[model samples]
Target: MKMWFLGTGAGRPNKHRNVTAIALQLPEPETGWWLFDCGEATQHQLMYVPLKLSKLEKIFITHLHGDHLYGLPGLLSSRSFDGGVTPLAVYGPIGLKAYIDTVFSLTETALDYEIVIHELEEEKQGIIYEDGRLRVEAGPLVHRVPCFGYRVEESDTTGPLLADKARALGVRSGPLFGKLKAGEAVTLEDGTVITPESVTDGVLRGRIVTVLGDTSPCEMAVLLGKNADLIVHEATFAAGLEEKAHEFGHSTTIEAARTAQLAGAKQVALTHFSGRYSNDELSQLVAEATAVFPHAIAATDLSMVKIDRVHERRAGQDEISS
Candidate 1:
């Protein structure tokens, strides 16, 4: 998985950052990429990245804020023109569906594929998306609007089967070997039992990532971020301006770092910076976050990042561990 930030500014777009859009490129089983938020002019930003609209499988909107959704309609239309035939699934708060419906209706636009919208009720919580490979949950975040934070968890994969050991044990290639590879115990013709534990190497831990919209330091953000490999939180202001940020339902760099620390997340990416800050000022923002969480860093537009992978190696004969 890789994250590409298309826009990362608060309130409006600047030469440095745009509003708020992020593209997460996932591997096999998942098509193109999943967009976090479609802020204004997000499609234009795609030129800097390798993502194509035709490959977008899903779109998760954090809120109905203009900065988070204004570019959606255009992206949708352009996607169709760009040969996006795959059905798109969009999830968000209550007004999300209505907003998209109204926009498409008003513009009299048509697309090549169907769109399935999953709208969450006020403060709704629980898994909003789940499949064989991915599970996404929504938790309400503290903001002026009914904003949300999303937690994306991937499914774990079984480790490779030790074919060499099996062959050495006289377990010839056949159905028994297939069963053993699938973690099933097999009784050979010799009446000896072979278990998956004796043949498998390890369990690959799935990745977890949390991406939040505009929000203040809140418990929901912490809940979604818990144990996440990466926490993408807003750093709309510097440390000393906590009061102002709080007033606007935003968070400072320090607060974002504190959330990552409290959530026990492995890494943090600070985004949604205030336009007033130039590159130098943004450095201070990253510094404050890193001071609290060593892995914290400021994310820039078009910068790519990956989640930390955790693999559990099978341990002793009695118990398997990572």
Candidate 2:
């Protein structure tokens, strides 16, 4: 799995950053990408990446801020024009359905595919989405209006069983190894029974990523992000301008870094930067965050972060016995 920052500017668009949007890309049986927040000019930003609009299956809106959702109508319209046929599910706070209706009604535009809107409330916190390999959850975020942060965790996978190890134990290169690899016990012609534990390792660990919407440093965010491989938080201000962040229900760079640190996240990527700051200023902002949490980085538009994958390998039988 990978996360591509489509737009990272906070309040508005800038020459360096466009607006708030991200593409969460996962591999097969969960192929395609899901978008979080569709800020202005989001389609244009997609041009930089090799994403097809038809493969955009899900959209999660954090809030109703114009900077966070202004590009929805345009992108939806463009999808229809581009011959997109796949239905899309859009999850957001209440009034999202009404907002889409009003925009489409006034613009006289129609989409070619089904668009399902899921209006979320604060009381709800669980699995909001589940597919073959993806499980996405939503939790409340502390914003001016109803806001939510999302945690996307891939389902666990068990990698290949050790063929050499199986052969070493008198298991031949036939269906017997396949059975043992699948965690099933098999009896050989010689009446020897081989168990799955004898030839295979345990279950492999999957990657977990948590993405925060516009929010302050809150307990809910920390809890949702706990033990995450990657924590992507909105950093709308530097520490010096923390008052502004508090006023707007956003996080400072330092606040984001500390949240990731407290959540035991392996890495943190700070985004949703205010456009007012220059490149040098944003660099300084990241430096400030790094001081607090060295694993933090200020993400740029179209930048991708590759997560570390953990696979299980069989231990030697001698070590297992020991």
lDDT of each: 0.88, 0.86
- As a whole number from 0 to 100, the lDDT of residue 237 in candidate 1 is 94
In terms of lDDT, which candidate is strongest? Answer: 1
Q: In candidate 1, where is summed lDDT lowest over 10 consecutive residues?
A: 313-322
Tens-place lDDT per residue, model 2, 1-322, is 7789999998789888889999988765566888999999999999999788988989999899999999999999999887788999999999999999999999899889999899997657888988756788999988898889999887765556778888887899888877876668888779989888767665556789998899998998998899998999999888987788888899898999999999999999999988778766777988999999999888998999878666655564221110
Q: Write the residue-wise lDDT of candidate 1 on 59-126 in tens digits.
A: 99998899999999999999998999989999888889889889999999999999999888878789
RMSD values for the candidates in order, in angstroms, are 2.9, 3.8
Give stretches of model 1 more than 4 Å off: 170-194, 316-322
